[model samples]
Target: MNVATARLGARALNRALLSRQYLLRRLDLPEREVVEHLVGMHAQIPVGPYIGLWSRLAGYRPDRLSTMVTNRELVRTALMRSTIHLVTPDDCMTLRPLVQQVLDRDLYTNSSHAAVVKGLDLDEVVAAGLALLDEQPRTPADLGRALHERWPDRKPDTLAYAVRNLSALVQIPPRGTWGGTSRTIHASATTWLDRPVDPAPSVETMIRRYLAAFGPASVNDVQAWCGLTKLNEVVGRIRSSLRVYLDDNGKELFDVPEGELPDADAPAPPRYLPEFDNVLLSHANRERIIPDGLSFAEWCRRYGLMMTVRGGVLRGNLLIGGLLNGIWRIDKEKKSYTLVVEPFTKVSKKDLTALEKDGHALLEFAFPKAESRAVQVLPSR
Candidate 1:
């Protein structure tokens, strides 16, 4: 494959990524279609996908996704990076098997549980765990206690962790439902989705999807996003079919032939992103979306404002003109919810006004039942 001499600057790559991620503009597509297009949403936090979809989809409703969860059309399961993701049943079946190596490596190298499970027969453990989950979905603690009956010498939680990493377990519903709180429960993905893992999962197809959603990226970027390694070989195999370009830094980038590259100056309205939004986390070098300068944490420290986490979810980010410029969080009180926006640097009045308007809309979507709603912008220090 002859490498093209075309070049793309950071802004050009940024626009292309934002356009692919639907951040440049909201789309009227169905939530399921959107979820599939982006591969999946990082869903360690139950509310993360709800807020993610709300920001990217037109007329998005939490109930629509909640209903999907209850119906088993969408599942929260361990997939990319061995982290829980909200994905369609089709993706779960296909992707879980494809990334099984990442999960296996994580189990053997994990500091907390690796030593305990060192000599045990992990295949036997996985089979037993799946049998138990097939009978009924169970929380990790409950599953651990049951597994302890067999591995009398190991820590119950450690045994459970082994099974979690070894098997394709899907966190059953009511667990991921919106406005609902429940213990994390697990069932075998085969049992939950009534589908076996894909016998022939495709790495090439996975790479193509990644590029479509978060691409014009380097090989390192693809590996970073999926927690896989040695993808350079896969990219090489498909190189001739890809459009090649060099970033300003001269790193080679790859994209699908039809991947859209919007103008560098395309208007990017203020977008409120959920905690762990894939757009921010999907790239190895996030300079395309997160502007170069002081890191976000450093900026927060300089301003004497801490980026807070509540119930395990970090504060959502504030994106202005296609770059991550600030952070926001919703503070819940007895009868009200307050949306707070804090910029890393001084923001112009025009940008602040736009942020406030969109911020209010987000407040309404996330906390419509609150007796009062307020949006506050902290002055840049």
Candidate 2:
């Protein structure tokens, strides 16, 4: 079969990402299926995935996700870029082994971590960690303190991070629940879930999963998402089984053959994404979701400056017409609630009105207790 390298424009790529991510249209699938389909939700913050699910799935309820955690159908684990994600138990078992190298690289390469763990027996540290955690779940600091008793010379933080990096651990429940606030607690995967991890992990399978969720992407994009390097060989190994495309820069993009490819001009509804949402952070080239005129790197700079200089700076995202056009946040007062939109570019009058309507709907979904609600579109800088 000939692998034709079709060129895709910015909007074409944008629509494809939205469709793949389930942002273009809400699905009627179960919340667990939705979480599994997108690989996992970026959930360093507990409430992030709640809003993420609400934005993508119609009739999403906080209880559904919270129950998943409570019942162990889903888990909060360190995966993909070594961040906390809300992933299925199966993914937790398999994906963790696949990205073990990335976690190891992160642990060994950090100067502080390296200094403390140098010449130490990582296996013993891991064994000790599992032992301590197997006894009962403990916060990272507590784990560190317990491990420090065994290895007093090493920095406690490094010892904790070592356990985090080396072991297949899951963040225990009540920590990842909606509107829940508790100290982060962890336990070995086998102990908590009573499930064994995949003994042999495959990078090729991981690549396929990534394509299914965030596809038509280059090797760099995959690396950017998972922090794994040397994927060119992995992509090459499966190239014959994949469909290929090219970005405007002529770089090759790969996707699963059966994945949906939506029309470039398809209407994209306004979406409210929580902070550190994977749609924004998952790809090396974020142009698929970011608008045409904005520079994502520069946007990061401006966002950082504004977050420091301006109080109440919008940290989450607002997608207008399939383009990530602005930042947004909800402001609640005694009787009134406001959804503030700060656009990075000048939005058309019609789009602004649509945004207001959608923003009010989001406010209702997010904060129904308020007596009044309004969507405020701020002047663009």
Candidate 3:
């Protein structure tokens, strides 16, 4: 449980994260179980959750997850530092009280969100939103307008953030379902699940769950991953059970007692991750695992965007390697996808073949079945 045992070498870290994130091999477990294991699923692009499950499950079932959302087993709620996530309905309840601390912290000076919601009655807004949604779920815009009728002076934008984010709500199914493209509307999580929400549990439990999935990390990493703050004390209590290691830069990292620290020589293969993969967003220090040459910044202009979300960014698709190699976009008009791979540098024939295969799969998974089904290899300029 000391620095040396936790050193774990670099490749060891990569394998552990990939395995824990369900990327190394597809597992055969219930969809709900997987969601719980990962704490929650990263949900930026609505359909990304299905592909994410596909990449992780042994034989994936889109229906099961879709059904869960439909049946209220899973709910789409803004969570974990105010980012969207597909968490189990139970988590939605249990995690809310724990999340309030995060929202409160952001209201302070020099914070990114900076009390964008100051002077608002958070509870009243929550009740008003629930009342509007009780009749039928409404898109965020629809709900906001309805609420605005009651409070004319409030900035609808600020009011909506308070109701939708600060309170308990879910993005009903069909919005987040496979092939159901539409704007996000808000629904009351309580009404949708027909279950009373649980008060947030101790931060200690939250820290343990995060470590179970993405451990051997620092307190800062946990905060970054969850978008929560004020947890140094929870870390202190768990320190006895954790093993610590110094990063290449000499910062101490903490991990679970059972977290696997594999062999330094473990070999990893190329992995095509969905947008905002937990692997990409789970660390305060992403470079610790993502090689410097392949850091996502080259692909990401902002936090949620990537050069390629589904397939290709704006006209180019990305041809990435073990690290990000480069980005690309196709020039097709309709029904056809030409591979315009712009690797970081010239790739060998073997690597080119791999890139082509990965790119093709990404396109098929990204677009509707009939559209963009064909991938033509274009001459790299």
Candidate 4:
């Protein structure tokens, strides 16, 4: 269990994340178990979660995720730093409380009027909203209008945040399931699942799970992933259960005593990560995975979307592997989706052949009507 060979390096970090995040290869574990292990899946785009899971799980049953949502085994809620996350119904019920302070801090820091809602009958509003949602899931707009009408004086945005962040809400099925295109909506966890929601699991339990999946990581990295800063106290309390290591610069990395730390020399493949992959976003010091200067959002803006020189709406496809190796796009024309790969690297004919095969396979699995793909070589600037 000792990560004795762990050196502080990017290759090591990438390989560790691959092994932990289930990205090195697909897994056959239950989807709910995978969701719990990974904390939660990024779900801004309805299909992105599916793409994320498909790339990770060997036995990816799209139907299971959908059914989990329908059955409330899995729930989507505005958790984790005010972004939507696909978490287990049980998890949403428990972790929502632990993250409340963090979510409140984010709201206060990011939004101006969070303090204004402090005096409102938060319990009553949440109760009303919960009662409304308990009967049927309602969209943000619908929930907000209802709450605002009931309160008759509160700001819609602030109320929306209160209801979403303060309550145990779940995004019901067809909103985030495969092949579904719908805006997010909220339902009470108990009502949605047809059972009472469970209580909070300790932060110690959370830290253990996080480190188990993404270990040899600093406490700060864990904080970034969980979006909290007050875990210093908890970290102090859990030292007995953790195994610690010193990085190259003599910084301590903590992990579970029973976790597997891979050899530092294991060969890593060129992994194609879906956007917002937690490995890229979950670390304060991401030098271990992405280079220091790599800003995924910036790269996406520059390469993924086409901007007008004179200023207009951005209208272009997302360019994958921007400035890293190659650029790729998903072309959805004529009711069929096709992946296009344009490698900026000097490709041997053999490499090009391999990329074409790999890219098409990726496309076909991701998009059903992906009839074919196009691969072209672009000169490196």
TM-scores of the candidates are 0.95, 0.93, 0.83, 0.84
- Report lDDT (CA) for all predictions: 0.85, 0.84, 0.67, 0.65
Model 1 C-alpha lDDT per residue in residues 165-265, reported as the tens digit of each score: 88888898789998777689999988888889899999999999999999899999998789999999999999999999998888899999899999999
- Residue 351, candidate 3: Cα error in Å is 4.4
Candidate 2 Cα errors over 4 Å, as ranges: 292-297, 303-315
Predicted structure 1: lDDT: 0.85
User: In model 3, which runs have C-alpha deviations exceeding 4 angstroms?
Assistant: 1-4, 59-64, 104-117, 293-333, 337-342, 345-351, 358-372, 376-381
Q: Which stretches of candidate 4 lie over 4 Å from their true place?
A: 1-7, 59-61, 115-118, 293-295, 298-327, 342-354, 375-381
Point out the higher-scoring one by lDDT: 1 or 3: 1
Candidate 4 C-alpha lDDT tens digits along 153-270: 7777677767777777777767887766586777787777666645546878888888888876888888887887868778878876677777767777887878775665654443
RMSD of 4: 4.3
Backbone clashes counted, model 1: 0
Candidate 2 lDDT (Cα, 0 to 1): 0.84
lDDT of 3 by residue, 219-294 (tens): 8989988877767877887787777876666777787778775555554444445555666777777764555623
Prediction-by-prediction clash tally: 0, 0, 8, 1
> Candidate 2 at 40: error in angstroms?
0.8
